[model samples]
Target: MKKSIFLLALVIVFSSCNNTQKIAEITPNEIPSGNYEIKSIQGEPVYKLSFDVDTSENKISGKTNCNSYSGTFSLTNNKIEIGPLSATEMYCEENVMKVEHSLFEAFSNAKTFVYDNNMFVLSSETGIVLRAFRIVKK
Candidate 1:
């Protein structure tokens, strides 16, 4: 009887551990579309930088250190592609140009994005590229 009880408990335990629970993927259609105020790039803090995302139109526009940039982008299965961008030709200070260089590096690489906890994070395979919070419209 003890052996039979042990077997029953084992079956119950095994049945309770259901490995079939599906994790829903955030589809491209669900990618947030709006203006996100960037707070950091390459894990370094910065201010006065932001991106305007229009997912429906596959467009991204934002400010660099001294230039206003526009680009095409796509998001699929949380992976991101930002690029082929054009920007205004205003010369900036050295510090501002440094920030723009970092921004361009992040823009010209492989990236993945996540919108969570009210924060939008763009990351590369090595580490985080930038982090931002969406500007909610009132």
Candidate 2:
């Protein structure tokens, strides 16, 4: 009888351990997965920049004024790593070219992300490089 009781207790303990591990595997800091409109770049307000994030697939696709770009992204807690992005090659005005270059550089240097009050901010080691607002679809 004592041996049977010990075995049952051991099984319960193992089950509990497994449950705790499963909970730990669940990430508490989930990526904000949705469409967002770019609000600013390098602290300056901007327009016409937007992106969509799919956390389930770790993908990011966006429009950069004159061109559309798609890329893979990975998030580890608050840290974000945007993979090499591919964009359509199209001729554009000088100003638009600058904006596109800045956008791509920002993604390359992005190190951290912050989402608060429906606003999303992407930052590098130096400081914030991009700020976006979550776009809610009707």
Candidate 3:
């Protein structure tokens, strides 16, 4: 009985550790420069959306599940702004256009960024977070 209880306790500890990780809030200087594919927005999954951010040049470019887009971004302290965005004129489905519009709007609202273990998060002042994973360049 004692051995079983000890084993149970050990299992619980490891399981909890795996589920809860220590996330480090990062500054603009600490933000890694790379292409990121969006996994979710505000905890809802987003498919076929990705972007590349160049911290050195303050440039951003990406696809919106339809047309290609390019923009300038500025990161100061904890605040981020992505605006003056330009995209190809290719017409996509109305549903896709709506989603793309919301995403760019979210970028304009981004306030803080954090590195959550395996994910990168850009959050807004109003509590919206865009979670993405790094895209390994070949």
Candidate 4:
């Protein structure tokens, strides 16, 4: 009886851990299509950009205040790849440029991303969190 009880407890623990791991794994298909606004980075207000994902084109495009940019994106097994980003050279106001630069740097360096409900978060291997909010359609 004691052995059976111990086995049951172990099974329960293992099952719970598996569920948690699954929850943490978010797929790109789960990400909604819409505009997302940068909210905070590492728990601080940083830069804001609007990201519009075009699944048909397998691209994510938007404006970062300083310029308009677009990039091809792919996801496999919950892993994200964003690259080949191309943008215009038009300049903007000082504040806008600052924000745009910050946003661009963050996106360029993002190693992993997760989309949860209305929030899309980017994180690095070291666990830095960059949060964004989905813009409501008007």
The per-model lDDT (C-alpha) reads 0.83, 0.85, 0.78, 0.73
Native-vs-model 4 lDDT? 0.73
Residue range 1-138, candidate 3, lDDT tens digits: 999999999999998888865755554345667888898876678888989888788888898878888889877766677778998878889989877877777777778776544467788877856888878555
Cα distance off (Å), candidate 3, residue 130: 1.2
RMSD of each: 10.2, 8.1, 9.9, 10.7
For all predicted structures, in order, the TM-scores are 0.75, 0.76, 0.70, 0.67
TM-score of 4: 0.67
TM-score order of candidates, top first: 2, 1, 3, 4
Model 4, span 56-137: residue lDDT tens: 6778888876699988877664556777788898988998876766666666667777776778887766665568888866
Query: Which residue pairs in candidate 1 collide?
Result: none
| lDDT value for model 3 | 0.78
Sorted by lDDT (best first), the order is 2, 1, 3, 4
Q: Is candidate 1 or candidate 4 better by TM-score?
A: 1
The parts of candidate 2 lying over 4 Å away from their true place are 1-28
Better of 2 and 3 by TM-score: 2
Over 32-88, each residue of candidate 1 has an lDDT whose tens digit, in order, gives: 778888888888999988889897899989887698988998877788899888989
Give the least accurate 10-residue stretch of model 2, judged by summed lDDT: 20-29
